[model samples]
Target: MLRISQYSSVSSQQSEQQYVPLKHVSVETFIKFFAADVTIKQVFRNDETKPIEAVYCFPIEEQAAIYSFIARIDDRELIAQLKEKNETQREYSDALEQGHGAYLLEQDEKSQDNFIINVGALPAGKECHISISYVSELDLVENGSRIRFVVPTTIAPRYNPNTGDVSSPAGTTSKYVQTAPYTIEFRCQLEPLKWLEKHPPRKGRVRQIFLLTDGEISNVNEVLDLCRSMATSTRIFSFGLGHSPSRSLVKGLARATNGCFVFIPPNTSVDIHVGEQLQKALQSYISGIQVDWNLGTTVMSTPTRIPPVYANDRLIVYALANDP
Candidate 1:
């Protein structure tokens, strides 16, 4: 945390403007095969001579399960617990009105991914740190060994045509970008496939091609053609980034190779988004899975519906046994 202390006393005639209390924010993420964990730390300081409050708005994954929130005011630490939305709001309001250092965390009803954090009543030259933690499942690529992970840094604006309720959740929308100063796009060349062809899949091995894109591509057919040729030898998993990436190209590539595609929306926290997409993709897998059981000589097994299962995935089986 950084503090600003250099300031000259203002003249009585000069009017003083409000100072922005937010200093900076830092985020860290850790990801594994099946899950992603994130920690966010925000620093707020009051540089002015009077007490003030600071409010920070941010976004997280819609599916994220936040388990911990801690507020540090110098040496004193306050851990926030889960409560009803209304209860949490009231408590935070009361604390702030009473001039106590209060920290509040709440999710937006309109969008689960959006969040508002309030730190109330910091005395002059004082600072506070807010820490948040959450966990979400990681998404599995079409291939068993490889997975996809993302951490969103920004939440792009969304358009709302209806005017009934104009208010939106925090971090939900912002000024839209009509034309970026410049645009850069990347595509797969498939030149690597030739190298892989020389060394074909042997034994029980699997080949995978993972694609991640943030924008639309003009040459969807060409990419599909290459995927079609390599379908027998490879599986391609695709991810569409941002609000409206090219669905045709993403799905077509995956479909051509008998793989899967997942669309990532804007305003999604990157790591959480990656984890959620991977988890969703893994859930779609229903092929090449089996369940086995061993029973006594006098026992018999009943039939049951077995959903598609895949390798390295979890399956729960329920069966009825009777005497033979």
Candidate 2:
């Protein structure tokens, strides 16, 4: 999952919120056994009259490794190359000064989970396509029966005391003409589950209840207790809407039922978030999961006990092998 924020320059004031209009985004994910390969393509257009350097910040899983970054600018394609940070920055600045196009990808200084992309000297009215590809090991969950993968779609705001500025909050509506009705296309392909072919399908049942509200619950304690009692038979997905919804109540109900929760700010579309929840609800549940270790050594695994795993989600487990 990727979240993006755009700025005119790297040195621009963080308080000044300026975003380049996102025209389209396409994501393709391929899953094979315990690994996933993901590719994301994003198109951004320059509407300002003058050429501007664009800065984009995005996040990925801490364990995910990125192997490719490519930028397409009006008949020219540039592939990113690795170099010392200072040297790369110097070359990027030189390219801008010489009126040439340059692209730079670097890990964020403050956080390893985040990355920064610089697109230098994009001319007015032009469009650039940025593609990023990465591969990550999928986690086994539900006693090693199901595989889970997640792509983050949101970036929470952060305050920087040094700059006296705050990172832009997620879910802010875009005002660009092209972005007002932007669309994101997503596709996922998974390898066939050989175990399913070998064993009979289980007769499992799933009961789902969706709750959407502005978080104005009167009997909060009673409601939460009721949700907790229904955990054995029901899954309650909750959505909190508006500016001042009761986050505690909304999140509590979902937590009690072992479900999911989403918070939608004012003026943002509700369908997208709802659709995502619906997709998760529709995944088939696999049961009777078991893992067999055959290595000739004593192995200790963190999370000595397995946690409940959701369908199509990743679970990471660390193991240490001890020689006999």
Candidate 3:
């Protein structure tokens, strides 16, 4: 499985003694060619009879270009204009102390991928929604074009190798995760590609199964076993959505079936373009692709074995040149 570091973490504590403030987070991403527009809506409610304040620390992609930020309390919405970091912090603090509801969004100074959000002075039974929007570009990769989007639902414990950095809260302890009164439900609409299901009626050829899911499956091992049994007939391609997916399960299935797995984040739009791209890729799919180098030419190439390559896929070759 590929490893990506510095992603947003959502707290998930199974213990009952922890206090969780934030309720639900809804993220919408619209992809346009190489660029994508992302919007994140965070809802927090004061379940208690008394007024309360909520603060949440999260992460955003380091390269994302954020443009809009707004806070909504009941029907009254407050648009946040860009200000100096210190000025913004002071204003938000003053608003909260005066019993007025306020919201503050800032980037973490120490870590490029970390962010902090402060939602304050929520009245009893009142709900606050904070929406943030940004735009970012997608990169072209091997095996045609691949796009990856990630949303963190759980904050994992961090291990800082550097201990001298006391200016930032890099080593501070965090709260545990528990079920909140307000539940967050995320829905993803996938345009089914029927072409993936068709298998060429020939020897040593296999059909591809694209499995798309936003949650974990209970029978992961069983599903893997089934895929192994059908290894001769079909190839399994697994896609996990959101942040808290079962990484082992998704990667295991692909590894077992000699296929590929990908995790899609909340900032990517799997719209009509996705389908068109898939169609283009499938049309260029070659069952068994091999590379041949000149024999006895004192040449060497890494990866020694080449996987299946599509027509649009870029073939990268790395070699070491020696003096004759």
Tens digits of per-residue lDDT for model 3 on 1-324? 001111111112121222445578789989876667889888766665555445566656544668998988867989988989888877875665465666777875534345667665567778878899988655344345675555444532332233342211211123323243445554322223223224332676767767776544333445455556655666666776665555545655665665665666667765533454355436645555555665546766643544444455444445654642
Question: Model 1, range 128-155, lDDT digits (tens) per residue?
Answer: 8889999865655443456666554443
Q: How many residue pairs clash in each candidate?
A: 9, 6, 7
- Give the CA lDDT, 0 to 100, for residue 178 in model 3: 27
lDDT of 3 at 9: 18
What C-alpha lDDT does candidate 2 achieve relative to the native structure?
0.61
Query: Cα lDDT of model 3 overall?
Result: 0.55
Estimate the Cα RMSD of every predicted model relative to the unseen true structure: 14.1, 14.1, 14.9
Each candidate: what lDDT? 0.58, 0.61, 0.55
Listed in order, each prediction's TM-score against the native is: 0.50, 0.48, 0.46
Candidate 2 has a TM-score of 0.48
Score candidate 1 by lDDT.
0.58
- Give the lDDT of residue 42 in candidate 1: 82
Winner on lDDT between 2 and 3 is 2
Off by over 4 Å in 2: 1-17, 159-324
Task: Give the lowest summed-lDDT range of ten residues in model 3.
Answer: 1-10
- What TM-score does structure 3 among the candidates reach? 0.46
